[model samples]
Target: MCAYQEAGGTDMKTKNQSPRPALPRTPMTVERGVALIEALVALLIMAFGMVALAGIQSTMRRGSDQALQRGEALRLAQGEMETLRDYSVLSAEAAASGPAGTRAYAGVVSAAASSAGGNTDFSVTRSVADWADPVVGQEQQQAGLREVRVRVQWQDRAGNEQFVMLDSFIARADPALGASLGLPASTSATRRPAERSVSIPVAAKDLGNGTSVFVPSPTATVAWVFNNMTGVITGRCTVAMGTLNSSLTAADVAGCSNNTVGYLLSGVVKFSSAARPDPAQPGGTAWPLDVGIVNSTLNGAISAPVHQCFDDAPTSAANTMAFVSFNCFVEPNNGTPRIWSGRLELSGLNLGGGADAKKVCRYSADYDGNGSVSNSEHPENYNAVSGSLSRQNFLVINATASCPAGAAINPENGVFVNNSTVQQQPR
Candidate 1:
């Protein structure tokens, strides 16, 4: 009984031990939580990579669309150029007209729409102009060259504007063909014999530094002649000035006095007739005249003499009014002169009512003979020169004229003249 009782006490003690406190539940480890967090971060990174790849693909597609649009614009421009070439070759009149100006064509369809086998939206523009071949020896217009330009414009996939252009040249078939179109038979055929003469008095103000302004008096006269039978015209002019009163005071002139020196002033004189034809004139023709410098002298001494002449020749048969450029110059003894040299350009001298004219001239001087015109060589430093004249000066000449039949000059017959004077300043 004692042994059985002891066994029962041992079992009760084991049971009362509370099953060893369940091993404290092992307390959940931090390492397992860390592994789960790392998996979630990897999934987030993969999602970002997929999004970036999708964006790259979209950009590539846009680039391809842009390229396709540009190619289509170029093709359209080329096609228009070919069409113009064919039309120009088919008609001599069309080629001679040279587009008359800029012509615009309507837009077709969008590039994206056209790519999908639909219509295309592209605009085209064309322009034609007369192209003169640059002659080597002379400054004269060469007939029969034409320039053609074509432009193509369109929009890209991104709605950005795009454009392409093409250029081409066309020439006359033959010299005889040009002649039939009212052009000169040859370069020599346009030359005519000089047949008239004139003399005019001129007054000039020496601005100093190789520059001067010519002021024509009412006494100035132009003697000209026109031969209707041969369509030949000619004229000669002379401007003489004995002495010019200085614009500055005597004390000022003496303080800035200089030695008498020679100079040459050169430029072009152009003449254009009115668009309306003369009533008495046999043919309803608009004539233009260009006379070059024949001879210019200073104190009875000839400087550089240039002999060139140009006459009115119509670009188109129905077109009236002609354009010509004549080189000219003058020399004067202004009593007190210094070394001077420069260039002159004159335009917009019309025989009729027309106002589009321009002139540009520049002059510089080496007063000390230092081989270059510097700031110290300016004429403003001299008291004799009232107006400020520096190393360069530009002047614009505006002159127009009207003449009737039997008048001393008639621009319709390609008749005109230039009278100029040169002077020296004390500075």
Candidate 2:
């Protein structure tokens, strides 16, 4: 049979073919497919790891940049605070005073580059406000106390808003030491002149008898100016008496009877010294003019003492005038009585001269003699004046009467002095 097979014989089923050499073993095709799958999976895992690492790196870089920006912001904020503090100190020293109520150094400063690339811009703003010491008495409210605030703003790299703020309290320097050291020569040389002025309405209350009381009008205005170089202070004030309740009619006023019926106030105020000094010396460092009053009907005037005058020297300009007191009495004998008393508070002291000079004054008056002041008795007033001097000049006045209540000026008329009104004018 083998010979037949080798010879290609036709014995169909009996011939044994050489077993076909086992079909070449097929080369383990399943194993080859599995190896390829494993290789693909390993590649996929490596790619995923690389991607995750990149994400982490990006996050770390962002975090680092944010930290840097935050640090820079803080630094800039501190720098701005220092700059403001320096300016305030220098200004206070130069002026020899603390800031008034609330004064802004200026508008927002120009934007500054905070980063080396100039991509980040920052702005600084500063404001100064009067700070009263709670521990101290009201008498020391304006002494050695101020609040300063500085704010810095900018945008971060991510286009997010960012800001930093610094707050501090500034105290007035010792007067003796400050004056001895003085300000820098350059600053002193650059000092500008100041103008002062005020306007106030006049009010009066009837105290009966032939006497009446006078005070600042319910609506009053005041202003002041200071000259750093000459150390002179110029001030002006205005009072309105149109609404005064007086017994004098248009005829009496026209006849000039108001002059004798009304009283005038005159007193000298010295800056850099105590109010109402024992001896009342002249030629002081700063001199305030005597407050004088005149009635439209009268040609003569009377003198009076100033009530509640404040001298803010230790913590402010050596010659600064803080507040003024004015009180007076008048007797027209027209069967009317009048009384008036009031005070003016001067704030926001500035160096330059302008309408702003009168912008920071507050006037208060007592109209009913209740010993309490009300908003109704206080009115906004304005004044305009121009002058340049180195000293502070202002007026403080008060008045009193010598007549008893219910006393009749004329017994025959049976129309004794009853309703009294005090009139005021600006000078």
User: If scored against the real structure, what TM-score would every candidate get?
Assistant: 0.30, 0.32
- For candidate 1, write residues 260-340 as lDDT tens digits: 221222222222234422313313332232222322222343333232222223334355433222212222323333222
Candidate lDDT (C-alpha), each: 0.35, 0.36
Candidate 1 local distance difference test against the native: 0.35
Alpha-carbon deviation at 225 in model 1, angstroms: 39
- Pairs with backbone N, CA or C atoms under 3 Å apart (clashes), candidate 1: 109-120, 109-121, 110-121, 291-326, 292-327, 293-327, 332-422, 334-424
Error in Å for residue 291 of model 2: 28
350-409, model 2: which lDDT tens digit per residue? 313443221111122333223443323332221111111111223222212111122212
lDDT of 2 at 59: 84
